[model samples]
Target chain A: MIIGKVSGAMHSTINHTFYDERKTLVVDKLNPDGSLTGDYLIAIDTVGAGAGETVLVIDEGNSARQIVKEDNAPIRSIIIGIIDEVYVKI
Target chain B: MIIGKVSGAMHSTINHTFYDERKTLVVDKLNPDGSLTGDYLIAIDTVGAGAGETVLVIDEGNSARQIVKEDNAPIRSIIIGIIDEVYVKI
Candidate 1:
């Protein structure tokens, strides 16, 4: 899992048959210093992460497949947890 | 996998024992219109992906373990493919 700040929510009407109830979000990755790095992604939101919230995103494809119970879900990233706090050595 | 645009790179000194030569990158998630969305990440680069290149990232834990031959690598994101183009309906 990596630390990220939710920038906004992505609204899409289209959905795959496997992931029908999931909502996608646009999130920006953060550096250790809490600065915006650059790697960004459209991740499936399951943990109710909203914009400006620090979240722990998991890109576990296999686990998502197992959770969704689909053999071949195209999911690569998902919001697993919302970070309450972070501690890193400078 | 979700489509994303590689906005920038992330450089980190700290690395686990399992991943030695891998370089970490900071990426920003993007909307389909190419606008900066909020989600971002620190991803392990394996496909020589650079800043400004739209890349495909895989968050496969079990498959990565099989590739790295380690039970626990603590890796969540890795660049699996680079996107040449994206086509989404309006």
Candidate 2:
């Protein structure tokens, strides 16, 4: 899983059918030291993570679909967990 | 989902509980134009993707588990499909 910060929310009126009950969020990838990696992705929110909160993102499609129990969701990323702390061994 | 090329294979005798029947592969993320982005990841193979094959990767955990029919698998990435062609409208 990749560490990311919820940066913003995305609203789309017309999207795939599986995204009906999901909220999308824009996430910026973060390094282990909590610094930005300058990369971003739009991910579905499963844990009600808010903007600026650190989240664990599942960046695969099938696993993302399984989180919502949709076998054929056209989604690739999802926020699975809200992280409180991260310990990196030096 | 992300497009990637299977660069190599991974073998771990001692791994997580869910990885017993899985084959791990090393994949390099690729851009739309078939160029390397220099990003690499280790992914479980659901399909029979081999070295040098372009494949579609699911980077999520729940979906990865769903593909293998394991709910509590400690895996986050999996190869889902093999790509045939990519069309980019410039």
Candidate 3:
């Protein structure tokens, strides 16, 4: 899993069946030290994470499909948890 | 899913329940144009992908768990398919 910040929401008129009730968000990847990596990804939100909130992203496909209980979902990324804090020990 | 090249294998003495009999590999992320992206990841190989082979990676957690048919696996990344070719349009 990786830490990311929700940047914005994605708007799509047509999508796969698994995404019918899911909300897609634009997320900016964060380094372990909480700095931005300048990389962005569109991920489905399952934990009700909002913009600017830190979230835990699962970037695997089968695991993402397991979250929604779907066997075949076209999605590869999904937000699974909302972050409260992150501490790094040097 | 993202495309990557298998760099090497990973060996661990201790792991989770779902990792039994599974092979771990080191994969280098690749750009869409088939260039190296300089990002490396440790992934569980589900297919028969070996070193120096191009493969498709499922980087989500739930989806990865679904692939193995395990409801609770500590793994986050997994190899799903071996790539035969990649075509990009300018």
Candidate 4:
């Protein structure tokens, strides 16, 4: 899981079936040191991650298909968890 | 899957539950036409994606368990597929 920040929210009212009842979000990837990397993505949010909160993002096709329980979702990235703390040795 | 670029690699010696025996890679988020978004992440590589290659990342938990066929893996982010093209009608 990658540490990231909720940059914004993406609200759409149409075609994507995967995001039909979900909230899409823009997450800015972050380094372990908390430096902003500027990379951003629109992800489907199941957790209540809000803007500015540090979160854990997941990206896998088969894994993703299993999470949302959809076989034809055009999804790759998802906001799975909110990070409270991270500790690294060395 | 979200469009992204593999920026670097992260190799570790122990302690993580999900990434054991997997090659971890750092991916940079990118826009279409790839202008470099600056966000980066360390993802478990199941595919043979190399550095500088644009790929797709999946982020979800229960789905992750279903994909790798593991129930106790603490994984949320995974390198699922490589993006070849994207056509948005915006």
Model 3 lDDT tens row, B1-90: 899988765433232324446676667789988898967556778888887889999776677768877775646888999999898893
**Tens digit per residue, CA lDDT, model 1, B39-62:** 777777666777897765555655
lDDT of 4 by residue, B18-52 (tens): 45466667787788767767555667677788877
Could you report the Cα RMSD, in angstroms, for every candidate shown?
A: 10.5, 9.5, 9.3, 10.1
In candidate 2, position A88 carries an lDDT of: 33
User: Judged by lDDT against the true structure, how good is candidate 4?
Assistant: 0.68
Best by DockQ: 4
Question: What is the per-residue lDDT of model 3 for residues A1-90, given as tens digits with 9 covering 90 to 100?
Answer: 566899999777687766777799999987545688889889988777889987767677765676667777787787766665544321
Ranking 1 against 2 by lDDT, winner: 2
Model 3: how far is A85 from its true place, Å? 1.2
Using DockQ as the measure, name the better of candidate 1 and candidate 3.
1
> At residue A67, what lDDT does model 1 achieve?
59
Error of 3 at A70 (Å): 0.7
- What 10-residue stretch in candidate 3 chain B is worst by lDDT? B10-19
> How accurately is candidate 2 docked according to DockQ?
0.09
Where model 2 places Cα greater than 4 Å from the true spot, the runs are B1-74, B77-90
DockQ of each: 0.09, 0.09, 0.08, 0.11
Clashes of each: 22, 8, 15, 13
Candidate 3: where are CA atoms >4 Å away? B1-74, B77-90
